[model samples]
Target: MKDCENLATCGFFRKHLEAKTLACQGFIRQYCQGDKQDDCKRKIYKQQHGVPASDDMLPSGQLLAGHEK
Candidate 1:
């Protein structure tokens, strides 16, 4: 499948795509540009809430390390 339609504008990708952490980058690879894009919590939350989740929200629906925003 193609990459996510929201890749360019996704809050998570725009904010964290450049993160040096392997886990962070892995999330991007696993969701933003992979087959799992359809399951991204960020996309799901946006669809459900009509707004983006917090910047610290991972595509897996978890918060970033030490981050609860």
Candidate 2:
């Protein structure tokens, strides 16, 4: 499956499937906008660690294997 497809099945995504709150909605929106991808290091870290990402986390070039980019 594609990276985004895999992300779609993650527990976090599932939990916020129908949420209208900013955090949940923003996650979906950013993901759809291609902001969360292999090129986005913060997203890669969040996906690997299952942690919530923050604006303070800066982007890097490293990619997390097996994670949705």
Candidate 3:
């Protein structure tokens, strides 16, 4: 395989690849064996929208805006 000078310009670099950048797939398939499906789906959402669960916030409202689906 040819090396890419800039992966952004490489045709082999797919959009879904960003989802795997944080080792999220392995994290789900391994530690979260029972809830792998939900874990994987959440990771994919985070990758696409850059939204993380705000556990530190108050229960009534969100600190950062993101669609809750």
Candidate 4:
């Protein structure tokens, strides 16, 4: 699987990667840089809405607490 093409510009990743949380890293490995890239909720939300999801939105589609922007 290829890394997600959107990684460079993904707001969620840019915002959360600073924390370096294991959960965030896991999500990146599982969805952003793995076979599940196509299944990423960020990709799905953008594809379905024609706009990027909120920066706090995780790859799994769950919003991170206290990270809203």
Best by lDDT: 4
The reply for model 3, stretches above 4 Å from the true place, is 1-39, 53-69
Model 3, residue 1: distance off in Å is 26
- 1-69: candidate 3 lDDT, tens digit per residue: 222222243211232234453443343234234333333333344456666323222111223234131
Residue 11 lDDT in candidate 1: 78
Give the distance in Å from residue 61's predicted Cα in candidate 2 to where it truly belongs.
16
- Each model's lDDT comes to 0.84, 0.48, 0.33, 0.85
Best by TM-score: 4
lDDT of 4 by residue, 1-69 (tens): 788999999987787778778888898888888998998999999999989999888888888887433
Q: Is candidate 1 or candidate 3 better by lDDT?
A: 1
Instruction: Decide which is better by TM-score, 2 or 3.
Output: 2
lDDT rank order: 4, 1, 2, 3
**Residue pairs in steric clash, candidate 3?**
none
Model 1 spans > 4 angstroms off: 67-69
Q: What local lDDT score does residue 9 receive in model 1, on the 0 to 100 scale?
A: 78
TM-score of each: 0.85, 0.40, 0.23, 0.87
Using lDDT as the measure, name the better of candidate 2 and candidate 4.
4
* Each candidate: RMSD: 2.5, 9.7, 13.3, 2.0
Tell me which of candidates 1 and 3 scores higher on TM-score: 1
